[model samples]
Target: MTDQSKHEVQFFTLHGKRRAYVKAGEGPVLLLLHGLACDHRTWLPVIDELAKKYTVIAPDLLGHGVSDKPRADYTLGGYANGMRDLLTVLGIDKVTVVGHSFGGGVAMQFAYQFPERTQRMMLVATGGLGPEVTPLIKFIQAPGWFPAMGVLTLPGIRHVETLALRSAAAYGGGPLRKYTRDLAEVADILESWKDRRTRFAIRHLVRAVIDWRGQIVTMSDRAYLTEAIPMAVVWGREDQVIPVRHASNAAALAPELRVEVMADSGHFPHKDHPEQFARILDDFIVTTEPATYNRARFRRMLRSGMARADTTLASVDTALTTA
Candidate 1:
C-alpha cells in the first residue's frame, strides 16, 4: 500500500473553480500530468523521488480529482491553456512537462501552444500518436454507455463490480495475466465513477478525443514541430490500453525521439517500475539540452507544411546510422 501521508494535497482556485494538486521539493520545475479518469495520486509512485531532484507539480487536471467539474472546455487546447494559466499564477515560468496517457496529449498541446514555456516534453503511453486504442475506451464512447455506467456504479452494485475487478486483476492468470496491470488501472477508474460528476467529466472528455472506431484526434499533422523541442517517449511493451507500437509512430515522426519500452509492464510503466522510471527520467533531464524556441524557425516550419517524407526518413536513417 502507498503511504498517502507523504503527499499533502493542496487546492487553488482558477477561473472561480477550485483545482487540487500536490507540489513538492524544488529545482527545475516538472509539471506532471495524470491520465484521464486519474488524479494527482497516480504519480505517487515516483513523485517523491522525482521531487528530490526537481520541483514537481502534479495537478488533478480540472475535472478529474478534487478539481471542480463544470460545464467547461475539456479539449486539448483548453487543457494546454489551463496549464499555462496555472503555471503563470504559481510564478513558474517554464517546465519540463511530463504527461501520461491523455495527459500526454495535453503535454504535447502545451508544448505546441507555448513552446517558450516548455523546456522539454515526456510522453508515457500517451494518446494522439495513432488511431489504435483499447476497445474499452471506444466502448465508453458508445451511446447509452454513460447511463449504463451509472447503473453499473449504483450503490451496492459498485461494491461487487470493484471486488470482481480487483480479484480478476490479482488472480486471473493465463492470458489475462498479461493485462493484469491494465485491469488494476481500470478498476481505479471505475472506482472514481462512483461520483456522478467524475462520470460526467470522463464521458465528455472521452468523447472529445475518442470515437466508436478509435481515437479521432492525432498529432501527426503537427509532429514536425518536435524538431524545435526535446522530446522522449516511454511506453510499456505490454501496454494494452494504448499499444506500445505507437512509440514507433512517434519515432517515425521525429527520429530524435528517445523511445524506451519497458518489458512486462502494461499501461502504467511508472507504476510497474517506479525506480527504473525515475532513473530514466532523471538521466534524460541530465543528458538532453532543453529546447530554445526561435520565432523565425517556428514560422518557417509552419509555412513549409509537414516535413517532406523523404527528408524525415533520411533524418531517421541518419539518426540510426549515427547510433
Candidate 2:
C-alpha cells in the first residue's frame, strides 16, 4: 500500500457548489474520471502509482461522493462541461484526461468540445462507442426499477451499505474481500447515496442513460473521425459490462487511435492490472504529441453536414433493419 500521507484530499467550488477531490504528487496535469456509482476513491490505487510522476486530480462526479449533487440532467455533455468549468477554476489549461467506463464518454465529449484544453486522452472500458450493454445494466435500466432503487435512501440502515458495496463488487467482478475490508468507507458511500443531493444525482443519471441510449451510434456517423487527438484506449478482454468488442469498434471508427487489451481482467482494468495499465499510459504520454486541430477537417464537417445526416439515416436504417 502506498503512503496515504503523501496525498491530500480536498474540496473546491465548481459552478458555485463545493466538489470534493483528491490531489497528489506534482508534474504534468492528469485528470482521472471514474465511472457510474464510483467515487474518486475508486482510483486510489492507480493514483498512488501515477502520483509519483504526475499531478493527479481525481474528483467525485456530482452526487457520487463528497461533491454537491444538484438536481439536473446528468448527460455526458453536462459532466464534461462541469469538468471544463473545474479546470478553468483551477487554471489548468491542458490535461491528459484519463476516463473509465462512463467517464470515458465524458472524456471524449470534453476533448471534442474543448480540443485546445486537452493534451491527450486515454479511455478504458468506455461507452459511447458501442451498442452492447450488459444484462445487469439492462436490468438496471428496466422501467419501474428507478423508484424501488431509490429506496436505497432509507436512513439508518447499516445493511444498505453492505449491499451497495457488494453490488458494486459483483457488478464489476472486483475482489469482494477488498471492499468488505473497508467497512467504514463502504458505509460512507452508501450513506452518501441516501443524501438528498446524491439521490437527485442518481435519478438524473438514470434518466440520462435512457435518454442517451443511442448516442454513440449518433456520434459515430459525424465527421469527428478527423479527431487528430492523440488518443489511446485500454480495455480488459474479460470486460463484462461494455464488452471487449466495442474496443475494436471504437478503434475502427478512429483508425489512428491506439488501443491495448488487458487479458484476464474485468471492467476496471486500471484496478485489476495497474502496473501494465500504468506502463501503457506512460509510454503513450512519453511518445505521443499533443493533438493539433485540423481546420480543414472541421470545415469539411460543416460543409458536408452529411456526417450528422448520415448518422441519423444510418440509425433509421438500423432500426428498420432490426425491426
Global lDDT of each model?
Answer: 0.86, 0.71
Instruction: List model 2 lDDT by residue over 1-323, tens digit each.
Output: 11243456688886677787888888989999988667887787688788899989998887777687776548888888888888887778889999998888888888878777888989988876656665544544556545654575576454666566555654543454333333333344456555656655765675566432433322365424436578889998777676677776666566778989987777777877888888889899999887666678657766666656565546543542232
Worst 10 residues of 1 by lDDT: 314-323
lDDT of 1 by residue, 260-283 (tens): 999878998988899999998999
Position 126, candidate 1: lDDT: 97
TM-scores for all candidates: the values are 0.93, 0.80
RMSD of 1: 4.1
Best by TM-score: 1
> CA RMSD for every model?
4.1, 4.9
Which residue pairs of candidate 2 clash?
A: none
